[model samples]
Target: MAHADWSDPTPAAGWTIAHQIAHLAAADTNVLIAVRTPEAFDAVLKRTEAAGSRHADLEAAAGAAKPRSVLLDEWRSGRAEVAAALRDLPTEHGFPWYGSQLTATLMAPLRLMEVWAHGQDVFDAVCAARRPTDRLRQIATLGVIGRELSFHAAELPLTTEPFRVELAGSDGRTWTWGPADAEQRVEGGALDFCLRVTRRRYPAETDLTAVGGDAQAWLDNARVFL
Candidate 1:
């Protein structure tokens, strides 16, 4: 599968399967560097920015230079290394991310979210269907937590009032956040909520329903990742 169809473009912004894997591999490498040698990670960021190079551009260039086998091996090995580094770190220890610092625990979930989201792109490229998993609970939780950040990103006023989030998990369990009787509420499948917050799917494309002004506003401008 890897050798025969590496160049096939996916539905995700028309990125090839190799490009999707390359992005994950590159990101995992950066996380490993951030955990082990923060200065090196910072240097990479500075150098990339100085050269006017986006991370996507760098990932594509690197992927294009390597064989499909090499890229897959790197992605597998790099992710293992990142997992090990995160496990070895103290729970309270924090490391630099794109702009902010995140503890090992926080970083781990973000990594999972990236892999799952990008995995969907790869699966779609190969005409494969992936059933949703309970791991989306982590993503849905992150989306709810990022409500304020989303508002800030959209250049909208932050609502101080809390909004309830109720999502049905893939396993049929309900995940609820915020007040039980809040006037503003968002209710839907966990996958839809995660996809919506990640900007993978527009609000209109999902079955998620937003009630009240604040909840509707959040649904319109949700972004779980930077």
Candidate 2:
């Protein structure tokens, strides 16, 4: 999108198209720092832990102020560097992130999910349709594994009881997680589940149906964040 389009508002409240890209840049930078220097990452965590969302907003605002050409080049270069850094990391490596540890293997997929999710906001802002692709499999898998992440971040009580998830993929197939016979189950379109978990759309607005009270509660609190 052009500079004018960058000013256009996205679905995320108080955020613009530029904000989406800028946020991505900010997040990618954090991932890069985490992988490269643990001590530096700890410093970052210390600084941002106090500011929280405000810190992110400030970073996005700063990134948005740069010239479009500069922003694109910087974001692109940083992402490529991050990819290279991740590639060099040992498969068994673990990095501290946002109050938790993340495996080296999961970083790439998590980054992809963030890119797609933020891109959705930009696409929506510009009235463009982005077709769902097989990449959603990675996101849906993250959504399942990270179901408790949001709870943990929010300091909510955690649950050990598992809930079954069954999603109808865009490719006319089923993707499932957890025990099939679990009493609590969530069944829905894969796209809807991804959007719900990403906090892009309210669960009530999606095609998902919750089969149990716990399932509904999970749907409400579930969110994708590193």
Candidate 3:
């Protein structure tokens, strides 16, 4: 996985480390609404929206209030609850998301990826780097979800076949997913790969390999929603 212990200062001036941590913590909490009540998952959607607004307020106020340690504790607790929900939800259970049904087990990694990706925002606020790992493969695998989202949002037809993603981390282990000879192949360091999908790194500024026409463009506008 492409994991990191990053601690660089976030470039978003209004956002502090505490605010980033709290936003992710809040997002994790919002994801859980889908688990406890599949029929009530619309509430989950609304909650994420609410969380975003709340985070905006928190980011603005972060300059004035709260202890760092206390904020960290709150963030940790919120993450724990999300982890528990991800671990406990059964495979047979499904949640409503954007008019679709998603099994909890399949959705767990998405939740994990969200935490790991957003966690980088906090890490950047402190100027640190985490160790690279195999877990990044799991996270980047979600990039396939991007094609669907792009097609939906841009009103263009995009292929759904898995794009081959290969990463050679700073540690030298090559982590890969999908078939090597697939229509598209994306190669880069674990950090860059994660940063790309998370919309943190622009392809030109990073050592990313995107094969096939419009592959990079596909990635450029890739968003989580349809």
Q: To one decimal, what is the Cα RMSD in angstroms of model 2 from the true structure?
A: 2.1
TM-score of 3: 0.74
Local distance difference test, candidate 3: 0.65
Strongest candidate by TM-score? 1
Q: Provide the TM-score for each candidate, comma-separated.
A: 0.94, 0.91, 0.74
lDDT of 2: 0.85
Ranked by lDDT, the better of candidates 1 and 2 is 1
Top-lDDT candidate index: 1
Residue 138 shift from truth in candidate 1, angstroms: 0.7
lDDT per residue for candidate 3 within 54-136, as digits (tens), equals 64555435522556566567667877876787778776777776457877666777777777776676566556677756777
After TM-score superposition, the amount by which residue 212's alpha carbon in candidate 2 deviates from its true location, in angstroms, is 1.1
Segments in model 2 whose C-alpha atoms lie over 4 Å from true places: 2-4, 150-157
Worst 10 residues of 2 by lDDT: 1-10
After aligning candidate 1 to the native by TM-score, how far in Å is the CA of 180 from where it should be?
0.7
Q: On TM-score, who's better, 2 or 3?
A: 2
lDDT of each: 0.86, 0.85, 0.65
